[model samples]
Target: MSIWWSIHLRRDAASVPLARRLLLGTMETAGVDPDISYDLSVALSEACANAVEHGGDGDSAEAYRVTAYLDGEKCRIEVADSGPGFRPPSRPLPVRVASVEDEHGRGLFLIQALADHVHIGGKPGLGGTVVSFDKLLKWREDAPLIAV
Candidate 1:
């Protein structure tokens, strides 16, 4: 079975958890393993949090979009924002921070570490940013499984 969903939300902090909760619910209903679902939920939270924090120019009407698709054993998600696009870093992303006290700059790093594949790009003709990622879904050996 294949499942997909898309939602556009105002660029606000509350929208972050809303997006994460929707994704988590969908994965859970699809029989995704708890651990995998948790990891993806956390990653989705980071992605949505980044959108809420950096995805607008103080315009309350601006919005971000989240899309998810589950096909076979893979789950793919895309988060697109309405803010000025940014060029992705050209070097390898660091997995750890230089200082424990640093409170920022870890979203992309966490997303990269959690997702099996990640793509960052500009929304075509929209003058904004899009972050897409995918993960291979795995089930525990003894768990009830849904045929994907």
Candidate 2:
């Protein structure tokens, strides 16, 4: 079975949970293993939070996109934003190690740690960024969606 979804969300704090909840509901209905579903949900939350915090101009000039695809035993997701885009030495051209005492800056790292594969890129100053990732899925024995 192949299932997919996408949502355009404003860079609002409340929008973060809304995206997460929808992803969770989709996974649950598909009978994804609870642990795997939880992991993906957390990753989705982090991605959405990043978008809410840094994906746009300070004003209400930006919104972000999140897309997810579940095919057979793999799940793929992508979060995109229209921002200043990534510039080297500033944005996450290369994900850095956030110190333990740091209150922020771990979102991308968390996404990398949770997913099987991750890719972060954008056209510098061209006004867009994309964080894409995928993971192998584990389904419950009673999963309604047959892994095709």
Deviation of model 2 at 70, angstroms: 0.8
lDDT for each residue of candidate 2 in 14-50, tens digit (9 for 90 to 100): 8989988988899889989988888888888998887
TM-score (C-alpha, index-matched) for candidate 1: 0.91
- CA lDDT for candidate 2: 0.83
- Per lDDT, the best of the predicted structures is 1
Clashes of each: 0, 1
lDDT of 1 by residue, 1-148 (tens): 7889999999988898899999988887778888888888888888888888888898867899999998889899999998888998776576775588878788898899888988888877877889899999976555344653
Compared with the true structure, all predictions reach lDDT values of: 0.85, 0.83
User: What is the Cα root-mean-square deviation between model 2 and the actual structure?
Assistant: 3.0
Candidate 2, which ten residues in sequence have the lowest lDDT sum? 86-95
